[model samples]
Target: MLAETARPTAAPPTPPRLGFLRGWDTAIIAAVLVSILVASLTVEGFASPRNTGFLLIDMIPILLLALPMTLIILTGEIDLSVASIAGFISCLFGALWSSGLPLETIIPLCLLLGAVSGAVNGFLVSVVGLPSLAVTIGTLALYRGLAFVVLGDQAVTSFPRAITTALQAKIGATGIPVWIIPVLLLALVFGVVLHFTGFGRSLFAIGYSEDAARFAGITVARTKFWLFVASGAIAALVGIWWTLRYGSARGDNATGLELSVIAAVLLGGVSIFGGKGNLPGVIAGVALLAILRNALQLASVPEDTLSMLTGGLLIAAVVAPNAIVWGRTLRRKPHTT
Candidate 1:
C-alpha cells in the first residue's frame, strides 16, 4: 500500500472576540442605566413624567450640536467655535426679527450666516493649512464678540406665542416634547450616514492617516470644509430651537455650551485623538450628563458645583480611555525568557 501522505492539519479558527462587550460605548450605556436607577431611587419625583419631559427637553440642544460635532472629531479635527456660532446666529435671529423680517425669511438667513461662519473656519483650517484647534478657537472669540455687537446685552423675548408653544408642546401624556420626534429623525439620518455610508468610512480613514486617505482618493480638504459647514448649519438649527424653547434670544445664548457638547462627545467614547465613536453612545452620553445634572439640581446642588463636576468628568473621560489602552498594550507585550 502506498504510504498515505499526511494532510497538514488546518489551524483552528480563532474565536471571535467579544469586542462589543468590551467597547467603551457599552460601558457608557451601562453607566447611563445605573445612573438612572440610582437617581430615580434616591431623588424624590425624579421618575415623574413632568420631570422626564423637562430632562429630555433640556437634552435637545446638546444632542443636536453633539451630532455634527461627532463627525468633525472623527476626522481628527475639532470645532471650538460651535457654541459661539449658535450664540451668534441666535443674536442675529433676534436682530432680524426686531427689524421686522418674516420668521420664515429670518430662519433661512440665520442658517446661511451659520454656513458662512463655518466656511470661514473651514477655509482657514482646510485651505490655509492652519490647525483646526487654533482656527476654531479664534473664530470662537470672534463670533462671540460679534454676537454682543449684534444684540448687545438686550434679550428679545417677543417671539410668537403659537410658535413657542408648538416648540414646547408634548406628545399626549408622555411628557416628552413634540420636538424630540424631529430631533430623533435627524439623529437617525446622522446614524445612517455615519455607520452605513462610504463618506463615513472615508472620515475614519482620514482620521487614521490623512496622507493614506488622500492617496486612496478622498478629498480631504473639501470633506473637512463641508464637515464644518454642516456643523455650523446644525448649530444654527440648535440656536433656533433654543431661542424658541426658552422664549428668549440673547447675545449670550448657549454661552459655554461647548463644554457640555465636547464633554458629552468624549464621554460617549469618541477619542479626542479621533477616528472612533458611534451615535448611540453619544446619545447615551448626553442622557447621562443631563440626568446627572437634573438629579443633582433636584438634590440642591449649586451651579458652581455642577460646573466643577462637569470639568472633572471631562478630564476623566479623556484620561480613562488612554489609560485603558495603555494597560492593554502592556498586557499584550511578549514576555522575556
Candidate 2:
C-alpha cells in the first residue's frame, strides 16, 4: 500500500495594518493646518493677534462641549439636549443671581441642575431602554422650553467685572485666552482616559456591539448614564463660561450650539453611526470649523451662508466616510470575482 500525499493547511489571513499618518485623524489634522495657512494668506485680519484671541475665546464653548460629546458618540449614542442644557443652566444662573445668591453658590447649583437634567435623559434612554435619539430629541425641546420658563426673554448683564475680565484675559504676548490652559488640560485628561483606559476600550466595544459587550460583563446602562451626566455637567460649565465671557446670562445663551458641536464631531472624522473616532481628530475638527467660521466672517460672509455651510459639512461628514468604504468594497468585489 502507498502512503497518501499530505495537503498543507492554509495560513490565517493577517489583518491590515494602518500606516502612520494614513488615518482619518491624520487627514483632519493636516486639513486644519492647511486651512490656517490658507486663511492667513487670503483672509484679511484672520491672523491678527486681536482676531486670533477672539477666535480662541469663541472656540471655548464648542471645545469644552465636544470633549464629552466625543465619548457619548463613541458609545453609539447622541445627545441633542446638550446645547439646551447649557442654555437652561445659563438661565438658571441668572435667576439665582437675581434672587441674591452669591456667584459661588449659584454656579454649583446650576451645575447640579444640569446634572439632574441629564439624568432625566439618562433614565429614559438607558434605564427605560428608549432610543437615545428620540430621548435626547424630546429633552432638547423640554430643556429649551424650561429655559424660557426660568428667565423669560430678559438677559442678565450684571456679573462681576473681575471674573468676566479674567475669563477673557489673554496670556502675555501670545494672544491666547487664559482660560485655554484649563480647557487644554481637561482635553488631555479626556484623551488619556479614552485612549489608554479599560473603560475607554469598553466604550468602543459597546459601540461596536452592545450585546457582546454586555456578555463580556460591561455595565452598559451604568456607563451610558454616567456619560449623559458628564455631558450635562460639561454643558453647564460651558454655560457658565459663556455667560461670563460675554458678561451676560440669558435663556438664549448657546441656543443652536448643539448643531455646531455635532457638526464638529462628525467633521473631525468621528462616525455619526459611532464606534470609531479619536480625540485628536475631534479637536482638529473643532479648530477647522472655528478657523473657517472666523475667516469667513472676516471675508464678509453672511451669517445665513455660514449656517448653510455648516449644515452642508455635517451632511458630508456622515456621507463621505460610508461612501468611501462602499466604493472600496465595490472595487475589491470585482477583483475577487
Candidate 3:
C-alpha cells in the first residue's frame, strides 16, 4: 500500500494591516499642529484669513514643485536643475511674449522647451549612465546659462492684469486663493499614484535595488527619464504662474528656489537616499516651512535667521535616516552571552 500521507493544510495568510503614519511623519504632523497654534497665538494677524490666503498663495509654486521632487527623491535620484528650468522657462516666456507670440502658443512652446530641457538631463543620467547628481548639476548650469542668453538682463513685467486677477482670485469669504486647489488636487493624484499603483511600487523597488528591480522587469531608465521630464514640465508651469502672479518674468526669477523645495522634501521625511515617505508627510513639511516663514516675516525676523533654519532642516533630513539605520543595526547584532 502506498504510504497514505496526509498533506498538512497551509497556514492561513496573515491579513494585511493598513498603515499611513510611519517614520518622521508622526513627528511632522505634531510639529505642524504646534506651529499653527503658536503662530496664531504669538504672531498678531497670523490667524487672519487674508494673511493666510497670501501665505498659501506664495507657497503654491513650492507646493507644486515638491510633488515631483518627492517622486524623484524616492527613486534615489536628484534633479537640481528644477530651479534653473523654471528660470529658463520664465526667460523663454518673456522673450516669446515680448516678440508678440500669442499667449497660447507661448505657453505651449515654453512647456515644450521645458520638456526638451528635462529630456537632455534624463538622457545624460539614464542613457549615458552618468550619476544623477553630476548630470543635473551640469544641466543646472547649462539651463541657467541658456536662460541668461535668452533674456539678457531684461525683465518682462507687463503681463495682462486679468491673468493675475484670475490666478490670485480669492476663494469667496474664506480668503484662501484659488491656486491651492491645483496644489491639493495634484497632491491627491501623487498620493494615489505613489501609494496605490504598480508604477509607484516599481519606483520603490528601483530605489531599493535597481538590478533586482530590472530583473523584475521594471523599466528603471524609462521611469527615471519620465520623472525628470515631469519635474521640468511642472517647474516650467510654475515659472509662468509666478510670472503672472507677480507680473514679472526675468531670467533670474525663482533663483535658488530649488533649495526650498529640496529642504521641504527632506523635512517631509522622504529618505534622501530614497525608497520612503508619503505625500501627507511632504505636505506637512511644506506647511511647516510656510508657517515658519510667515510667522517670522510677521514678527520682523531677519531673512538670515530663516536661511539658518533651512540649512538646519536640510542637515537633519540627511542625518536622521542614517541614524535610524545605524540604531537598527546595533539592535540586530547578537550580544555575546
Candidate 4:
C-alpha cells in the first residue's frame, strides 16, 4: 500500500545541441573552402600541386610563429618582436655561415639566441612589470636593428642545396612540404595542452584576470615568462627555417610578419580581451588567410588590396561579437506590469 501510494515521474531529458562551430571557426573554414573553389575555377594553374606546395611552404613561417602567438594572446599579452626576432636569427645565421660554421652548429646556436631574446622580453614584462604591448614594440625595433647590425644590408645565399632541396621537396602527392607536417604536429600538441590540461586552464584564468589567477595560485608571472621565451624561440626558429627555405638570409626577412600573425590570431575568435580562443579556430583562421592571399595573388590582386582585405577582416573580427551583443540587448523587451 505504501509503495503504490505514490509513483514518481522522471525528469525529461535535455535536448540535443550543436556546439561545433559555435564561434568563428566554422566561418573561417567555410571561407577557406570557398576561396579554394573560386581560385581553382578562375585562376589557371591555381589548383596545381606545385602551387599548393609553394603556398604551404610560404605559410610555414607564419603558421609556426602563430602557434606561440596564440598562447601569448590567450594570456592577454602580445609579442610584436616575433618577426624581428626571426630576422635577427636569419641575419645571425648568415653571418655565422659566412664565418664557416657548420649549418648544424648554427641551427642550435640561433635557437639559443631566440630563447634568450624571448627571455629578455619576459623579464621586462613579467619581472619589471611593464606593459606587454609597449615592451614588445620597443623590442621589435631593437631586434630588427640588431639584425641590420649583424647583416648590414648583405644577403647570404650560399646555403647548401641539400637542406634547401629537402625543405622544398614535396611529401608524396599531397603537395605539402615536409615542414608543413610540423605545423600540424605543433598544433595538435598546443590544442591538447590548451584544452585538456590544468596548465591550459590556467592560461584562460590569467587571461580572464591576472589578479584572479594570482589569487588562485596560478603563478601568472612565471607562465608569462615561459610563453614569451617560447614565442621568441619559435620566432627565431622560423627565421632560420625561412632562410633555408628561400636559400637566402637577410636582416629584413619576414618584415611586417607580426602584423599578419596578430591579425590571424584575432580573426580566429581569440577575443582582444583574452580568455576566449581555441587552437582549432586559430588553425582555421590561419588557413583562411593563406587561402585568401594565395587566391588573390593568383588573380593578380594588388598587394595593397590584400592588405586592405586583411584590415577589413581584423576589424570585423573585433566588431562582430560586440555588435551581436548590442543587438541582443536592443531586441529584449522589458517585463510588463
- Among these predictions, the greatest lDDT belongs to 1
lDDT of each: 0.86, 0.84, 0.83, 0.83
- Candidate 4 C-alpha error for residue 193, in Å: 0.7
lDDT of 4 by residue, 1-337 (tens): 0011121232212211222267456777777788889889988888999999988887888788889888888788889999999999999999999999997899999999999999999999889988888999999999999999998988999999998899888889978788788778988898888877888888877777666677778898899999999999999899998899888999899998998888888878776766667777777788788888888888899999999888887788778866866788988968679
Candidate 4 TM-score, C-alpha based = 0.91
Model 3 lDDT on a 0 to 1 scale: 0.83
Lowest lDDT sum, 10 consecutive residues, model 2, at 1-10
Give RMSD (Å) of candidate 4 vs. truth.
9.4
Supply the TM-score for candidate 1: 0.93
Off by over 4 Å in 3: 1-19
Q: Tens digits of per-residue lDDT for model 3 on 185-289?
A: 989999888878888777776666676677878889999999989998998998888888888888888888888899999888887766667778888899898
* Ranking of all predicted structures according to lDDT, beginning with the best and ending with the worst: 1, 2, 4, 3
lDDT of 2 by residue, 22-79 (tens): 5666777898999999999999888988898999998989999999999889788989
Distance (Å) between predicted and true CA of 160, model 4? Answer: 0.5
- Model 4 misses residue 46 by how many Å? 1.9
| Candidate 1: residue 288 Cα off by (Å) | 0.8
List runs of model 4 lying over 4 Å from the truth: 1-20, 332-337
